[model samples]
Every structure is written in C-alpha cells, then in structure tokens.
Target chain A: MSAAPILAAFRQAFAEAWAGGAGALLPLGFLGGTAVLVPLGIGSDTDTLSAVGPGIIWVSLALSSLVTLERIFQADVEDGTLDLWLQTGAPMAGIAAAKTLAHWLAAGLPLALASPLLALMFQAQASLELLVHLGLYALGGLAFFFWGGVGAALSATVRRGGLLISIIALPLYVPTAIFGALAMTGGIGSDGAPMLLAASTLFACAVAPYAMAAALRLAAD
Target chain B: MFAGQGEQAKPLPVTLLTAPLLTARDLAILRGERVLFRGVGLSLSPGEGIVLRGANGAGKTTLLRMLAGLTRPEAGDVARAAPHHWIGHKEGIKPQESPRGHLALWAQAWGSKANIPEILEKMALKRAADVPGRYLSAGQRRRTAFGRLLLEERPVWLLDEPYTALDASGKAMLDAVISSHLRSNGAIIASMHDIAGFPVTAEVTL
Candidate 1:
C-alpha cells in the first residue's frame, strides 16, 4: 500500500503526543522524580549508588513507559478513529506500529535519553562507558513501549485501563529488564547480555504490532 | 444544481441500473444473549437508497454495521462489491482537532485529492473550519463528520442516525447532497428516525 495512511497516523500521533500540554513531558518528570528519590531513599554512598544506578534506570524506565500507553489506543477508539482505520484498507499492524512508535518518540525516547543524566544523578561515572549505557537505554525503552502497547491495545475499550495495562505489561517486561541490567553489570557467561537485550527488543518490535492489531480489532468490535 | 454534472457522468436511464452493489441475506444478530433480529435481508443497486426505521432498542445500528462489514452476522452473510463509507454516531472528531485539520488528515489517509476549501464550504463549516472540535456545537460537529462523504467516492454509504444533531438548514443541505449522490448513481443505507424529505427508495422497519 502507499505510505499515505501510515504517514497520516504517524503525524497525527506525533502531534497528539505534544498537544496534551505538559502531559508529553510526564515521563521525563517521572524519571526526574525517580532520580531525585533514589539518592534520598537509598542513601548517598558513592559505591552503592554507582553499583545499582543502571538497574534503577531500567526499572524506572519500564514503569514510566506505561504512563502514556493507556491512552494510546484508548483515545483513538473513543474518538472513532479506530472505525475509520478499519475502513481505510491499510494494514492495521502497520498503523498500530506507527502509532506506538510515534508515542515512543514523544514520551519514551526522552526517558531513554535522560537515563544517562539520571545515571549521573545516581552518582555513576562520566566516562565513555556512559554513552554505551545510553544506547542500551534507548533499545530497552523501545522494547518496553512496544510491549506496553500490546497491553494498551488489549485494554483499549476498558474504562480507566491504566492499572490493568501495567498489570498486563509488567510480566512481559521481565526478559528485557533482566538482560538490560545484566548487560550493564557484566553478568552471565560472555558478552551475550547486550545481544540478548537487543534480541528482546527486536523480538518485541517484530511481534507487538500484530498482537496490538488483533486486540484493536477486537476492541473495534 | 448539485445533481447536474457538465458534459460527463451521462445519466443512465432508470431501467439501466447496474447489479446490486451490496446484498445481505438471512442476517441474524444477537445483543447480550437477546436475539435482536434475524432473517433480515437487504439489497442495494446504484442510485438506490434504503432507510431503516425502528425503536430505540431495535437493531438498526447493528444492521448498518453488519452491512458495512464492521460487524459479523451470527448466522447470515453480507456481500459487497466495494468498500463503504460508514459514519457512526460518534462523528470521530477528536476534541483538540479542528474541522480543517481533521479533513486534511482524512484526505491524506484516504489518498483523495478533493479540494478541502470546497468541502468545508459545502458542509457550511467555512466559518468554524479552524475552531477546535470541543468549541463547536453539536450540529457543527455532525456537519464536519459529513465532510468525509465529499472527501472520496464510495459505492455505498452506511450511515447510522445521520440526522441527529443537524439543524434545519443542515438537514436541507444533507437532503441536497443525498439527492445529488443518488443522481450520480451512488447508493445509501441510513438508519434514521424520520425520513425528513430524503429521497428514500426503500424502507426497512426493524
């Protein structure tokens, strides 16, 4: 099919991400809150802070990724965009992927980019290694948002589905969380942790859209 | 004047109406374990219009959705020669989106190059074109919803309660458009309370 439908969905989603006032920056605020609280709650010991900093970032990222997902498909369903999409004859999976990816760029990407700074706030080093960790955060964040999108689509028709979305998505997030933390802490047999993390993200990217499409179809019914 | 096309769209004689563009036979639907309707049937040819009349609990919307291919019948089947334009009760306009922006987005999505300004003018939304949906009156939003009809040409139109929220002038505008579409060999199936001057060719009471 021509790229027009997908482009329209993407552009609309991208614009909606920023149109909600300060709502778009909510993830950043969430990450910033976690960054501030970690130092206060866990004490300011340098060794302990640096050791657990990466894991904290991943956990916070996973939690905050669910923030915007509840509204992703729910809004479309309410506003009747979902019905129009059903009639458009474009691949629903592609539209689902485009919408989720747009939301990721709006809400999830900033959380990933802010992780390095958040790591610094947790007392991690300013070495070149920080850049590598930044890359990992971006990939991990994408995986989280995509998986969360499945939950969002599934619960799109339910009223006040935020908590239900978290309940459904948290279990799916386990693999990415484990591998992401392991990749940072140099755990496991070899240098396979980062590869496993990348694989998890890739797998989510490939499969989440189809799952979302099926759920959205059911929601439309 | 809206029904007349210059030089082209040669008006076919009434007897030359083409084969049915949409047909449904023995259609049955259930809502919440209650049998809403069954053995329902409909057929539409070019330049034909069907009006569905029923009480509040009747299955008018369900039948419309079934014909539009949005809902599957429990026992029967629907055959469509082409896609349909479905305008449900929701109107589909986002609260933050203006009518102009909404139409522009739909034009791109449907890959239609219809003139946006002309469509807005036709819908009587020229004055409120750029105002956000939340600020528009119910009638204005319904008119914006009707704008999709002009965005692209579809063989069959499946409209549910299309006249709800339309003012007298808006209703008159709709009548003119519907007559124009019928003159061009387009078909329409609308679930409505009152015909309200629509040139309905057939009526189905659920």
Candidate 2:
C-alpha cells in the first residue's frame, strides 16, 4: 500500500497539534501540574512520597493524555476532513492509526520525557531506576492514547464529548495503569509487570486502530 | 450526436467506449428517522451532468452523500467506476490553514500531482492563496474548495450546493469549468437550485 495518504494524514494531525500551541503543550503542563500538586495534597515526607510517587505519575500521565483526546478526531470531523478521507478511498484504519500515533507523539511523548523530572519531584532515586521508569512511562502513555483514541472517534459527533471520552476510556485503561504502577513501585508480584505493561501497549496497538476506524465510520455516517 | 465526432473510420467502436460512469438503482434514504425519499434511480455516462433540483428538505444532500459512499442508502445499490470528488457544504478549510496549504494537503492525500500554482490561478485565488482560512471570505473559501476538483482528474464529481456562496463572476467561472469538464469525458452530479448556462443531460427533482 502507498504510504502517502497515511503520511499526509500524520503530518496534518501533527501540524495541528503544534499549530494551535495549546493542543501540543496543555497535556504536558497538566502532567507537570499534577506532579507538583500531589505532594502538597498529602505530606511531602520522603517515605510517603516515595511510596506513592510512581503510581501518582502513572495516574497523571493517563489523565493528561485524555486532556487532548476529545479533540483529536472531533476537529477533523467538524472541519470535514473525515469526509474528504472517505472520498480518497484510503484505508480508514490507516488514517486513524496515523492520526492517533501523531497524537501520541505530540501530547503523550512530552509527558513521558518529563516523567523523570516528575519522578525526581516525587523523591524517585536519581539513578538507573529512573530511566527504567521513563521507558515504561512512554510505553504506558502510548497505550493510554490509543485506547483514548477509540473513545474520541466514538464521540466525534457528540457536542462537548470530553466527559464521554473519559468515561469510555478510563475503564479500558485499567490493565495498563495497574501493570505500569506495579512495574514502577517494585511491589509484591511485580516481577513480570514490566513485560505485562509492554504487553498491554502491544494489545492496544493491535486492536485500537480498527476500533477507531469503525467508530469514525459511524461518526461520518 | 455521435456523428459530431467526425470519425468516419470506426464510429460504432467509438460510441461503445462511453460506458456509464455511475449507476444507482432504487436508492432510498432517511433523514432524522423519517423516510425522505425512495425509489430514486439515475445513470451517468461520460460527458453527462445530472442536476438535482428540489425544495428545501427534499433529501438532495442525502442522495448525493449516498452516491459518494459517505452515507448508506436505506435500499438499493450504487456502482461506481472510480473514486469521485465530493465537495459538501463544509468547505473542509481549517482556520489556521492557508488556501495553498489546504490544497497541498489534499493533493498529497489524493495522490494528485497536478500543479497547484496553475489551479490557484485558474480559481482566481492567487492573491488570497497565502491568506489563512479565517481571513478569507465565504466566496474565497468556496473558491478554495473548488480548487480540489482540479487537483485530480477524477471520472465523477459529486457536489452538494456547490454554488451556495459564489458571486456572479465566480458562478460564470464555475459554469466555464463545468462545461470544460463535461467536454473532457467527466460526469457531474450536482445539487443546485438551478442550472445556469451549463448543459445538463437530465434533471432529477424529488
């Protein structure tokens, strides 16, 4: 298959993420804000902070990714890009996958890159463990974005569907969040949790594109 | 009409080459949980134009969407020889995108290598090519949307209310383009309140 259409879609989506400025950086700021506020909400004790730091980072990462999901496909639908996509006769799944991947690159990746700083703030060791968690955060962030993309496509036609997207996507995020938190905290039964975290992301990679494609088709109809 | 080709060697074979580009049989559609129209059928051949005329709320847009494969008909089927250019009410123009940038994106997605500068000139949009979509007026945006038609040589064109916001000169320009497109063996199925100064093969009124 020719990759021109998919690549063009990717460029269009990625450009929009930065063109508006708010779209590209709001999630990063949100992630950083949550990382800062969590310590104040509870106590900043080193033991307490270390006990829940990684888990808190994972939760905020997932939530921050959702901040951008509601507009991912909804803007395309509103601006008639979806109809043009249908006319081009390219695989809708490919277009959906490209746009979602662009979203992950724009909104999710920054949060992952900042995870080391967030981890530092939460008293995570400034050592090799931080790098391991950084990698894990990237993978887990991708899973969250893909699953959230399905919800975004499903609600593309609904007005103010941000809440609806969160409702639909949060339940699907359970596996990744649990596995990623366990992998980070090194708690009991966490030996295979890192692999399981990667597996959850792989499963999302396998399934979310087609699900988004079907939902987008319905939205276009 | 066949005799106007001025080919005496093999007129019969030349005539046989013009097969129907689009065909629909007994198409039915609904709007807002109500049956809008049913039993609609039309055939479009090379160089033919089908104009859909009806009052407001007559399902013209729905029928066009069904033919473009954007919406499914409640009944019957549509067969198309190739992909079509569908221009709906929404111009697909992003507020932050310039006319040139919008066309460039479409060209890349449609895999059309047509010259954008030439299309910009043909559409009288050279001056406004670099202006952002939000800065463009309605007529300018409509003209930008029409630029997509020239970016690719598709066999069929399905336009919904294409003349909605065009001025007199813009309408004349569109008429000229429609005539040229018909002369080049391209079929057009458009919904409009009236067909002004353009040759039409048939009219379907609901």
Candidate 3:
C-alpha cells in the first residue's frame, strides 16, 4: 500500500516503455503535418497555424496521450512480469496512482512543455498571450493522463485495443477541450468564467485516478 | 552425485492436523464459456498427497489456478492456506531473466533467500545461472522451475506436470525432493503424468 513500491514499479514501467519507443511518433507526425499544412489551408491574410494552432495542439496532446496507453501493460504482460505485480501484496489503488503519475510524466509533461513552440509557429500575437495559451495547453495535457489511465486500464486485458483507445476516450475529453479552447482564444464570455474553466481542468485531474483504477480492475476481470 | 537432494521434490511431510491445508467442495471452473470442471470436491490435509489425473484439456490448469487463488471458482468452496507454493505446467519462469535472478524473484515472492549457488549446484543449473531462461533447453528450464520450489516454506505445495523435462538423475532428484517434503509432514497436490517418484502419499485422480 505504500507509495514507494508503486512508484518504483511505475518508473520501471515507464523506463521500459521509453526505451522501447513508447508512444508519440504518430501524434507527433500528425502535428508536424498540421503545422505545415494548416498554414497552407488558410491562404488568406489571416495566418494559418496561428488561427488553428491551439486546436491542433489540443488534439495532438490528446492523441499523444492516447498512444502512450499502448505500452501500459503490453511488455509486462507479454513477459509474464505482470504476474508478479498482480501477486504483490499491495493494493491496486496505489498501483493506479503510480502508473498515472508515470504516464503523465512520460507522456503529458513533455507535450505541455513543448506547446509554446507550437503556439509560436501559429504566429500567435504576444508572448504573454502565447504563454497563457501554452499554460492552458499544459494544464489540459496534464489532465489528459487521468483519462488516458482509464483508457489504458480499459484496454489492459485486450490484446490490440490500444489504438482503438481514442474511440473509448474521446468522449470524456470533450469538456476539457471545450473549456481549454475558450481559455486559449480569450473566449471567456463572462466575468470569472475563465477561472471556472481552469477549475474544471483541475477537477478532471482529481477524478481521473479513481475512474482509471475501476477500469483496470474491470479489465483485469 | 546429486545425493539425497532429489530432482523433483517429494511432497514434504508436515505435521498432521485436523484443519485441512487445501479444501474445495463442489468447486467448478468455467473458462471463456467452457466448463472445465464441475462439482469437483477435494481436500488435502498435512502429510497427505494426491495425484491429479485426467486427459489433456480436462481443466487441470484451470483447477490448479483456482486452487492457487489465481483463478476463482464458479461455484462451491475453494479455500487454502495463505502463501502456498504453486508451480504451473507452463514453465512460468521469465525467459529473458537469468536463472539466478529468477530464483531471487522466487525467493522474494516466497520469503526465502535464493542461495543461488546452492540451488544451481543442486539442480545442475550452475552452468546456466547467468544464461537467460529462454536459452535453456526444456529440461533445463524445468530444472530452473524446480530450483524455485527449493525456497518454498509453505506446507501445501501445488505442482502441475513438474516432470516435463527431467532426465534420469533429474527424475530421481524430483523423487527425493518429494520424499523429503513428505518426511516433513507437508501436504501436496501434484498434477503429474507419471507416478513413479511418490510412493507413500495417497493419490487422488480427477
């Protein structure tokens, strides 16, 4: 039940995934394509990626998070390593917590940190404005891992459902995208509404772990 | 040269007790819409031994898993003492890991120090200690699995097809190990195709 063993397990899981080319290539490729193509799509005086940059960033973060789910149980399960994990005297809740934390660090944290460059490519206006958008993107990215955990757990037992995860996960991500989009483009209609959007992001983060754990137990069954 | 340390362990003899070490009443196993076994009743007390015999695909693995607490029964009672040692038929040892490391992991799980050299020497696995488990021959891998059983402290042992890759000497070692365990008054339920090694314990066939 302690945090240490679970954390250690998570680190080991994450490291193995990283060494094995853990998710991000597909999403990164898609984003890179959008970065190049979106500017071409908007041929008018209105810039391209700038107009669509935030949206693409949001989608890419979601995709990236989704891709990482493929690695959650693949290697361990294949190698019979998970037998030991499941047999350990520890509770599942702690295991879920550690897994989510590692997923966020490996998958979400880097995506968020790189959001500013994406924002700049879109020809965003001011540094402060770009920072706000990037900040919002970062929060949104962090929030996605919880959903990803749930998705990963849902797919844990299945052999090849990792790619199908977007179908299972995209619905839960709608609210975050909506609130995040509003926060990004200065679309807050009323006073204190932006704060509400930020609050929702935090709320998603809080609720993710429990839901993911439940999904994992169900998947395991 | 292997001496009294047998290849396949004898079901260690444990003190006889009224409380059964392993019990299942009306137990049933269903795997993926297939009923493996139904109304299986079994009980093994200390110093008792039973051989699980049936045709292939007769739910031997499923029943073993159910008994090991790795799988749940669909009906009836399947109860056991906590922390009993179980070795399935699949050579469940991790292939990429070294023999020594696998023993260490087994030790960790069963609460015993691996004493790797002693185990390797006893099992004729000393030469393969540093080799990956996958690289070993079938008999060698089975030997590796037997090495893990050496560290088992529990009174109840559930072994499935443990004779799979053993040689003449290896088979003798197994017989000796089972004898030693029986001598210690431990209870054993082993699913095996051959019954030449264990002579004293009562045999139950399903």
Candidate 4:
C-alpha cells in the first residue's frame, strides 16, 4: 500500500549486495580478469584484438552477471527475508524488480564503468562513441539481471543453484548477447541493432518481474 | 514501554472468546509421495496458543508452514483475519551485516514502531549488537530471530521449532515474550517436539 516498504527493500537489497565487500567487487573482478586473459591467449595482433574486442566485452559482461545471479534471491530465501516480504503483503513482483535493480547497480554499473578500461587493455581505443556503447552495455546488463533473476527465483529452493541458474538463464541471454555484440561492433551506424537491444531490455524489464515473482512464490510453497 | 499502540494497548480479556482469528479445516499435506499429515483442524481465537506436537519426521514444520500460508495443503482451507508473522528454522540474518543493521532493515520493511535498542536488550543481544551475524552462536542467532516478534505487532505468529537452540535464559525470555503477546490478544501457533515450557490453550498432534 505504501511506497516506503518497497523503497526500503530496494535500499536494503542494494546495501546487501555490497555488505560483504566481496559481492560488489566480484563481477568487476570476473569481467576484468576475463578481459586480461583474452589478450594473453590470443596473439597481440591489433586488428585481431579490435575485431574481437566487442564480442569479448559482451561475453565477459554476460558471464560476470551470471556469476552474481545466485545472490539475487538465494540469500533472501535462505535468511528468511523472502518469507518476511511475502508476509508483509508487498507485491512479490515489486520486490523482485527492486532486488534486480539493486543487483544491476551493484554488479552491472561497475562493469559498465570499467568496460572502457578493459576494452583499452584489448587495444580498443577510447572515444565518445565507446561511452555510448558502454552505456548500452550497462542498460543491457539490467535486462540480463531481470531475465537471469527468473532462473534464480525458480531455483531458490535448491541449495547451490549456481549451475542450475546458468543452465536456465544462459539460453535466455542469447538474444541480448547477440544484439548487444552486433551494436557494439557495427558502431554508430548500426542503429537497428542498438534499438533492438534496448527493446529487449525494456521487454525483459516488463515481463521478468512477474515470471520471477511467480517462480519465487512457487519456491516458497 | 511495552504498551505503545495498535493491538498492544488493548487488554487481552476483552477480545477473548471472540470469533476465531485463524481457522484451518481438514488440512492435509503430501510431501513427495508420503502423506506427512492429514485431517488436521485448528481454530485459534485471540489470547490463545496452539502447540503442535509430533515426533521426528511428523510434519510439524510442514503444518506450521501450511498454517502460515507459505505452503498449500492438498485438501483443506486456512482462513485468517489478518496477516501473520512467521519465523522458520532459518534465522534469516545476513551473515555479512550486524544484528542492528538486520533489525533496522526488518523494522523498516515491516513498518514496526518498536524500539530497536529495547528489543536487542530484551533478547540479551546488546553485547553482540555490532557483531556480524555469521559470528553469532546458534543460541544467539535463535534469540535474534525471536527478536523479530517484538519488532512487528502481528495478531498471529507461526513459529517452527522456536526453542531449537535457545539456552535456559533464552527459553525463559521466549516464554515471557509469548506470554506478553498472549496478554495483548495475539495468537501463536508453535510447532515443537515438546510443549513443556509454553502455556498453550490447545494441542494438535500430527
């Protein structure tokens, strides 16, 4: 009935994402670590790095977000916060959305901010256009969490749901990953690709919450 | 300090013998292939407490969850006049945060007016107020979970194995809290292997 509870949940979820110190840094570390390993494995050829840079960044972002997916609702389920929320008469969908938003802020935002530096490591020069691309990646990251969160919610009853989450969510991530990579490499001229990516993000934002909420409700049962 | 607002200020005797606050009829639950329990019925009015007794694997926890509306029964109905509070086996404390931090979040979420410090003191967790939850002992964690009952004023409380890890003092504190809750016309349905320490008005064995 009141917005206060939902807002408080959002804040608490965000704080929880950073409470252990390690949670906030984990995605960034995974992204950066993966980016660093790319160049060492591949040859130092500039053209090769540039050609694969966008793909690598997209892949790293998806993987990193997946890495943190287990935290979205598992901790809440374990500690009884989920039960409390269900009892409070707050909409489960709203709580799921708030947690997903917080997850994006804590995990996705940092990855977006650090993407350019990671891209530069792969010899992709920084530019204003790169900022726009990174912003899209960040936006797409929110969608990633929303979609992956459904899997996380469904697997809430399962202890150590990391692998199950990946199995359930990775397939759902294909479209976003494809469109995001296309927009990244196709540059500013590929307006359709970015537009489609944005649309997917918006669609996921609208739909994932209900699906996640239902999954969580089932898990609680 | 205890009589602040809402139902807390009302005397329990006035609401006694009123309409049932919670009712469950012919509740049956099947876990996997096994029917854990069946034909369980209960009616709880204000100032009443029900202690669910059963041996190990007797579905005490399942019955509590079903009553709390967390789980659905295969065949039966549970009707409640108000939203109930539930404290399951899980402490629900975030290991990374302090007790005060966790309590603050819960209080805000539940819109509780209870004083946090007083609750911490009541639970005898004042000394461990700033310690991360993971560091808390089993007894301390159980006490912290019980502290949630004071934070929110709910008419019904569904507690599963509430005295599992409580020490002598903690168990005594729980008794006192439950008594006060009953005094305020609040109802409790607790599932326990033994109901020796509780003042239960009714008993249901599954």
Candidate 5:
C-alpha cells in the first residue's frame, strides 16, 4: 500500500485542525476572561481562587482544547476522507499524531498568544508571569490535546456529541486540570508537575495515537 | 485498453518467475460486539485481480481496510507485494488542497512520478490540477485519485468500489486503466459492486 498517501492525509488533517482552531479565537478569549471573572467578580472568599487564580489560564487553555476538538474529524468523517485515509497503507497512530499536532497549532498557539490579555484581565501577572504562564500553558495544552485526540476519535463515532465528549473527556481533565494548576503555582521549577505532568503527558501522548487509531478502525469497521 | 504492454501477453499477471503480489492467512478480528471476520486468508499474484463482494455490512470495506494496513486484523498474518494501491471511497483528495498538491503528496509517498502534466493528461485531469478538490465534482475527484495510481508505479491495486461516483465514461476510463495495469503483469484486488467491463476471476466474500 502507499505510504505517501497516508502522510498526505496526516498533513491535511493537521492543517485543517490548526486553521479551524485559530479561526475561532475571539470566543475562546471571552471564555478565558470569564474564568477570571468568577472569583474576582464575586469576592476573595475563595482562598483557592486567590491562590490559584492563575491556573485558570490552563483551564481556559484546556477548554480551548475542547473548543476545536468538536470538529477534529467531522468534516472528513462525513465526506469520505477518513475512509480514504485508512485505504492508504500507513499506521493509524501516525495519522492520529499528525492530527493532534494540528489541533495544538490551531488551539494551543492562540491561547498562548492571548496570554497577556488573560493575565492583564485577571490582574494575575506581575513580572515575567506571562512568560511563565505561556511556558506552562504550552506544555499543559499539548498534553491536553493528546487526550483530546483520543476523545475526538472516540466521539467521532457517536450520534449525539458535545455532552458525550465532555462526559468522556471531563473526568480525564481533572488529573490534567489539577496537575496543570499545581505546575503553574509559585515555585522554583517544574517540581512534581514537570515530572508528573511529563509522565502523565507521556502516558496520554503514548496511548492517544494507538487509541485514536484503534477507535478509527472500529468506527470504520 | 490503457494497461501497458503486459495485458497483451497474458490474461492473468501471475508468473512462476515472479513473487505473488500479496499473501495472507488465518487473519481474525474481534470488535466490541462481534467478530468481523475470522480465519480469513488471502493471496494475489502479480496481475491477479480478486474482487471482494458482499452486502454493505458484510465486511468488504473492512477487509480492504485491514489489507491496506489501516487496521491490523485481530489475529492474522497479512503480507503484501511491494507497490500496492488501496483506493477506497475517500478519493483521498483534500478539499482545500489543489489537485497537483494532492497528487504530489502521493508521488512523494509512493515513489513514482514521471511528469505531473503527463500523468494528469493521462488521467484527463490536467485542467483541474490547480483547482482545490471541493470545487471539483465527484467524477473529477475520482479521476484525480486514479491519476495518483497512474503516477505511482505500483503493481498491486486494492480498490473498494472504484466505481462509486463515476459517469459511464469515467467507468470506461477506469476499466481501461486496470486492463492496462494487468497487461503489465501487475495484480489488482478490487471490491466493486459492479464489474461487467473488467475481468474478475476470483471472489472473496465475508
């Protein structure tokens, strides 16, 4: 079977995910700000909000992952592109990874670009905070995309979406959401987050490709 | 009619001197609810054309998907002759990407390309080379995909309904192309709903 054809599928899938996600930054920005408004708008009764308000950026970023994932494989899945992709003689894992990368480029980059805006809106940054926030956001967002790929692939098969995706994906998000929040805290370095997140991210990343690919196989089957 | 010189020499592309293009045996798969196919065996010699036919859910497409290496069967040893083509209903063209760009990616992956223009002309897609796939009609898309086959010098073709959206002329064009491929002693395993024009000596149903 042809290998180039599969790579072609990968490149196209990546480009679509990136372009689609970046195209919708306005709403994502609003959502990010609202995440800030909750505690800041009400009061400081919440220690965790005052203490970990900064982490909301990752939450926003995580949701940004949800932002574009809904459409990840929908177009092609409907138009017969996914089946054609399977026709090409390449491992499904590679195809899944290429798409995940595309989602990050589209959704992750936008959140990073909007970091200063989010920081300023929340009054969360002091000095070099955007830099720290951006770094951690980049790492955490990438990890989130891996898991999202798995969700998107599985959800691609379902009839009713959104709710199911959130249900399936939300539980997984707690680990990432908590780990990401802890990682962004005031600290000298990555601490537990770097290793734990990297390891957790590793597991997510490692399993995502095969899992999504397998899901595609089942859906096609 | 368009198949190269090989079609004139023999009815089947198989030869004792050459290796069989593909071989598979004892292939099995298990899904969440039921078994898709079990103990599946397959082999195709050079220039051999095996048509997989069954009802919609009978696993024709699934079998092709597995042999194309999309999903490894749950239990089976599947092998292929180098330079095979598995064309499904996808047409595999990106709506945003132009025809040449789409074919260029295939050329890069399949290790075949004489000249883009010559190939497009052969497949009658030279005029649509610059257009994105979305703008093209269903026939044009299938033509462009078949153009990928022409540009790629592979010997084995695994096609699923190579006849989906083609006009009568387009169907004739496809039949001639496969005929020519066989002429060159290359094998084709096609899963088609309609197969009146081409020669199909074997059938595998799941």
Candidate 6:
C-alpha cells in the first residue's frame, strides 16, 4: 500500500485521540497522579523514592497505555468505519499499525516526555543521562500499544470489553515490561538488556499487526 | 466513443448489460444458535436494484451484510465483479469531528480524488458542513452518511434502511442519488420496509 492511506489513518486516529479536548490529557494526568501518589505513599525518603522511581514510571506508563487500548479499535468498530475499511480493500494490518503508531504518538509520547519531570519529583536527580534512558525506554511504549491493540481488536465484539482487553494484554506485556525496567536501571552498558528491550519492541511491531488484523476480521464476523 | 482503427469493434454497452454485477447462491446465516435466514439467493446486473423486504428479525440486515461481504454466510458464497459501497443503519459519524471533516477523512481513505465540497453540497449538507457530527440532528447525520456514497465512486451500493430517520427532503435527495447511480449503470441492494418511490428492478421477500 502507498503511504497516503496509512498517513490518513494516522492523522484520523491522532485527531480522535485528542477529540473532546480532554481525551489526550487523560494519560498524562494518570502518569503524573501515579507519580505523585507513589512518593506520598512510600514516604519521602529520598533514597527509597529514587530507588523505586524508574519502576514506578514504567508501571504508570504501562497502565496508562492500557487505559487507552479500548478506544483504539472499539470506536471504529462501533461506528462502522471498520466495515467501510474492509469494503474499500484497505489492508487491515496496515490500518491497525497506523492507528497503533498514532496512539503511541498521541498518548505514549506525551507520557515519555513527562517522565523526566516525574523522575525529578521522585528525587532521581534530573540528569541528562536519565532523560535519555527514559526516552529509550519510551520506545517500548509503542510495543505496549501494538500488543494491547491486538487484545482490543480481539474483544471488539464484546459489549463491555475493557476488562477483557486488560486481561488479555497485561500478560503479553510482561516480557517488554521486564526488559524495559531492566534496561532503565542497568544503564546503557548493561549486557544485552537494552538490546533485548529493542528486540521485544521490534518483535511486537512485526507480529502485532497481523494478529490484530485477524482479530478485527473475526470481530466483524 | 470510437473503436480502434481496422480492429473488430466490440460493442461495450451490450457486453456490460449482459454480465451480472453481483451474485449470491443458496446463502444461509445463523446468528447465535438461531438461524436468521436460509436458502437466500440474489443476482444483480448493471443498472439494476433489488429491494429486500422482511419483517423485523427476518434477517434483512444480515442478508444485506452478507451480500456486501461485511459478514460471512453460514453456507454459501458471494461473488462480485467490482468493489461495492455499503451504508448500514449506523451513521458512523464521529461525534467530535464536523461533517466536513468526517467526509474528508472517508474520502481520503477511499482514495477519492473528487472535490469534497461539491459532494457535500449535493448531499444538502452545506449548511451543516462545519457543524460537528454529534451536534447534527438525526436527519442531518443520516444525510452525512449518505454523502459517502457520493464521495467515492463504486459499482454497487448496499444500503440497510436507507429511509430511516429521513424527512421528506432527505428521502427525495436519496431517491435522486439512487436514480443517478442507476443511470450510471451502478447496482444497488437495499433492505427497507417501505420501498415506494424507489426504482427497484426486483424484490426479495424473506
């Protein structure tokens, strides 16, 4: 397929992500709220807060990505856009990938950008290196959205699929989450952990689109 | 139109008129545990239209969906010569986007190179063009969905309840659109309870 349709789908999904004005900010708020509560709950011991800061951020990012998964394909399925796409002979996998990319850009990218400030609040010390590491870890956010998208597509037919999507997606997210958290703390020099994280992201990118397309087709049926 | 020089000139109109545009055979559909319809069949040629009439729960929508390839038949096959357009009961308009934006997005997705404004105007959606879809009334939303049929050119149209929520003007616009489409050798399969004013070539009662 040419880049035109894919770009159009991406733009549409991005616009939808920001529709109703507050939809785009929900994830960021969730991230910041989680960050704030973690320090308060764990007591403001600087060492303890810094020690667990990266892990909290990763968890928050995963949860926020999950929060937006239901909207990825459900709305389109409900509104007949998927049927129109199918009839037009557009490749469902390509459309799925484009929407996932849009979700990552609209929701995941913002959370990644905000990680540095949240990390500072947790007393992780706002170092340039830490910021770069958080950015690198952000790449895994795309994997989350793509893989979670598969689950969302699978449950598209279910009237209330939010919980089912979480159940199906969270287990699939374990490996990426583990590798990503490891990379963050183990630093750039850590032997193969960062590489493993990148590999997981690439693997999800490769496999999630086809899985999602199949699931969407089944849901339509 | 003239044929190539010294070549045996083929009559294009006769050839198009003879071939079937869409065909279905002995179709069966089961929703959940109950059978919706069985032994259903239909064939459509260019410039033809079929109206499907059945009481509620008689599977008119399911039959139309099967014919459009949106849903699979339980025990039959559907074949079509060209890509078709489908308009379901749902308007499918995003509440947040304006009618113009929604139509433009669909036009882009369908790879339509036509002028968007002209199509919207033809659908009588010019006044509500900039209004968000959620803000549009039922009739306006249905009109916006119907605008898609004009946005992209296709060989066949499958519409379910095309008259639902349409006022007299909206119904007139729909009739005009359907008439023009048939004039262009386009085929249509519409499921509707009331088929008055529709130029139907055949009828299928379930």
List, residue by residue over B30-142, the lDDT tens digit for candidate 5. 66678978988988876677888888877788787778776668888878645466677877676676778777776654445448887777777778889987799888888
Overall lDDT per candidate, in order of appearance: 0.86, 0.87, 0.67, 0.83, 0.71, 0.82
On residues A100-218, what C-alpha lDDT tens digit does candidate 2 reach at each position? 99989988988898999988898878998888888999999999999999999999999999999999999999999999999877789899999999999999988999999999888
Interface RMSD over true interface Cα atoms for each candidate:
5.8, 7.4, 8.7, 4.5, 6.3, 6.3
DockQ of each: 0.42, 0.41, 0.15, 0.44, 0.29, 0.41
User: Which runs of model 2 end up more than 4 angstroms from their true locations?
Assistant: B1-16
- lDDT at position A68, candidate 6: 82
True contacts kept of each: 0.49, 0.59, 0.06, 0.54, 0.37, 0.51
Better of 1 and 2 by DockQ: 1
lDDT of 5 at B127: 81
Worst 10 residues of 6 chain B by lDDT: B1-10
Q: Which stretches in model 1 have alpha-carbon errors above 4 Å?
A: A21-23, B1-17
Model 5 chain B, poorest ten-residue lDDT window? B1-10
**lDDT score, candidate 4:** 0.83
Across A140-170, the per-residue lDDT of candidate 1 in tens digits comes to: 9999999999999999999999999999999
Q: Candidate 5, residues A1-221: lDDT per residue as tens digits?
A: 44554566566766665444454464366557667676666675545554656676776677767767766766667666677566555777877787777667766666776776666655564578668767766777777878877787888867656566667776777777777777767465547775676677778878888988887776666
The candidate 2 chain B region of ten consecutive residues with least summed lDDT is B1-10
| CA lDDT, candidate 5, residue A204 | 81
- List of chain B TM-scores, one per candidate: 0.91, 0.90, 0.85, 0.91, 0.86, 0.91
Best by DockQ: 4
DockQ of 4: 0.44
lDDT of 1 by residue, B1-206 (tens): 11112112345455536778899999999888999999999899998889999999899988987887777789999998755788898888877789999999988887777799999999999999999988999999989999988887776788899899999999999988888988889889999888547688899999
Give residue B91's lDDT in candidate 4 (0 to 100). Answer: 79
